[model samples]
Target chain A: MPPSGIRRRPGGRSARVRATVLAAVDALLAEVGDEGLTLDAVAERSGVHRTTLYRRWGSVPMLLVDLLDAGTEDDWRAPDTGSLEGDLVAINREVHAALTAEPSVTAAVVAASFRSPEAGEALRRFWEDRYERCAAVVHRAVERGEVPPGTDPRRLLVAATGPLYHQRILLGGPLTREEADAHARAARAAAASGLL
Target chain B: MPPSGIRRRPGGRSARVRATVLAAVDALLAEVGDEGLTLDAVAERSGVHRTTLYRRWGSVPMLLVDLLDAGTEDDWRAPDTGSLEGDLVAINREVHAALTAEPSVTAAVVAASFRSPEAGEALRRFWEDRYERCAAVVHRAVERGEVPPGTDPRRLLVAATGPLYHQRILLGGPLTREEADAHARAARAAAASGLL
Candidate 1:
């Protein structure tokens, strides 16, 4: 391979650098949260020189934006639970687990978005992709005649998942998996009645 | 009047000082969005010395906490529209308007909560009081036979309004008043079916 081509190889040094850096970012967010997160800390933890961090990411918010941008967007897919209720419960369970997990980076990333518009845009992209992937759950229900034809996937999804977020993230309360399923049931009932 | 009685009078000098300072805090939050807010700015804008602000509030988050605590908690009450659907629509309209307002202090305050544990506690207090006030809407509906007996008011209220916060604050999207009512309708339907 030519000398220049070696730099572009899959799993090359460049890819490793990014993976290592983002992993450190994730760990820092989980531990220190958005308030404690800084590019200096990222460099110190990752052993990547501060100059490279400054030249590339430039700021903590940008680093956070890139961290979310590098998430498993394509690798994840909605569960096939064979029924609308089951699918919604499964989705809510995943969401609740993510939001309630110990030292969740998700909470930090979300908080950081408020501090920066670029990070907020990155968050929008993250949610939009997530909604796109989860749209499959609603489409499956439609095909199975579980919900009304043209029962909006977005509205149904927002209804199903919004409460868990409200209670866990916004309200800062204890949220059990059972409570999340209750919200799923409510969403299911609403969709069945053609309200959503 | 006794000297002590004069100092304790309603709307006295101390109350005026607090009111003026909190108003400045609100203005700064709306103008600067949490990032630009500082105690020094509050001092300068409110004509209160930084020493008093430091001795009292101590930090930006605490100032935010006090600002929310000074809201119209007693003056505001839920609307009595004689039906659950009507009451819910009215409540959602108010929430949508507050959230969608240009340079909304609400967005700034909600964002500030993430930066401090005290601010987060204050936010929980804010929502709890709001929920308590809105519970009247559901109770009246129960009395009017518009919904089932023993329908939980908190869950119903969360269902009605969580979508707007999820869309506008968390996901960073354009939320129209119509979409808010749709959520309210879903909550109304869910409550009627005993899902909430």
Candidate 2:
């Protein structure tokens, strides 16, 4: 076995502590959400000392940015369904599900962004990468001649998925797969019409 | 002058207190957004006692609901631009302006909804009334035969405005009046295409 000083060294010990504390961030978010999330609460939930939490994450806004930044490690990609319509529906379905989840992490993260400019900027980076990934479907559609060249993928994707976010996140209205598909179909038709 | 007890009695006194306290809600929201809002802070800012705040608003969610409820007292109406595309652009301009406001109350209210179920429901009513009012433009469009008789007004409005909210609030991306107009134009075309 390693000596006590070696076992308590920075590298592995710090990583384990960070992983544990960040997991507690999600748990707190799931329960009381971002409003109730505090560094003291995190320390209590994480079983890490308050000094360590303050020394590391420092503030809730910084913690929120870190939490969202972790999402960039995901291997998320847009759906490829051989057509723009199918791809839009597939993408919106995932978004709809995430937004509809009880104690939705997506909704919480979006809410967190509004609480601080730092978190908002981090959320922007996370979405930029996701949109870049999803733009592939538009490129594929162009290659397949489903839509003409110069069809802006980001604009089309925004039109396809925006209503789901608006309905689910802001209006707190009922959303369904049918409604998601309808927006996707509208986007597809508009794209074919050279409007989007 | 009337006696101190009579001067600070229930009727007019309570009304003034409520107004003053609610004004503080907006001040705090502007300075620090919803996450920084607290009853103690409100009491301190408004010169109302914390007990009065607790007895009246009770909780943060209830305060949020009341703050949004105050907006309904406004006599807002959709633009009468005499055309579907014109009206859509007009409505989106208002939405875009609010979301992009420095210390945007619109974004703060939307973010507040995610923090509590009560606030979410209040926001729903707020949006519902706003949408119902905006539906007037679509009725005018239908009368002008811009779209078919059965064209759903709500779907068209959502398509027109959703992307603006998505771009400004969620993506935290750059937005402009021209982009808002573009989405409006797309929704108009989609409505005309009999797809929306």
lDDT of 2 by residue, B69-106 (tens): 87776798999998999999899989888887778877
* Candidate 2 ranges beyond 4 A from true positions: A1-67, A116-118, B1-67, B114-119
Worst 10 residues of 2 chain B by lDDT: B1-10
DockQ of each: 0.64, 0.50
lDDT of 1 at B135: 95
TM-score to native of every candidate shown:
0.87, 0.75
Error of 1 at B148 (Å): 3.7
Task: Compute the DockQ of candidate 1.
Answer: 0.64
lDDT per residue, candidate 1, A1-196, as tens digits? Answer: 4667656774586677788898899899888877788888999999998898889789999998888788744498888889999999999999988898777777878888876889888988988888888899999998988899979898899988988888888998788887788789888888988888
How well is each residue in B42-124 modelled by candidate 1, as lDDT tens digits? Answer: 99999999999999889989998887787735588888877889889999999899889777787878888876879888888
Q: Fnat of the models, one by one?
A: 0.59, 0.63
Model 2, span A65-131: residue lDDT tens: 8877877777877898877888988998888888777777777878878667798899898888888
Interface RMSD, prediction 2? 1.6
Chain A TM-score for each candidate, in the given order? Answer: 0.91, 0.87
lDDT of 2 at A184: 85
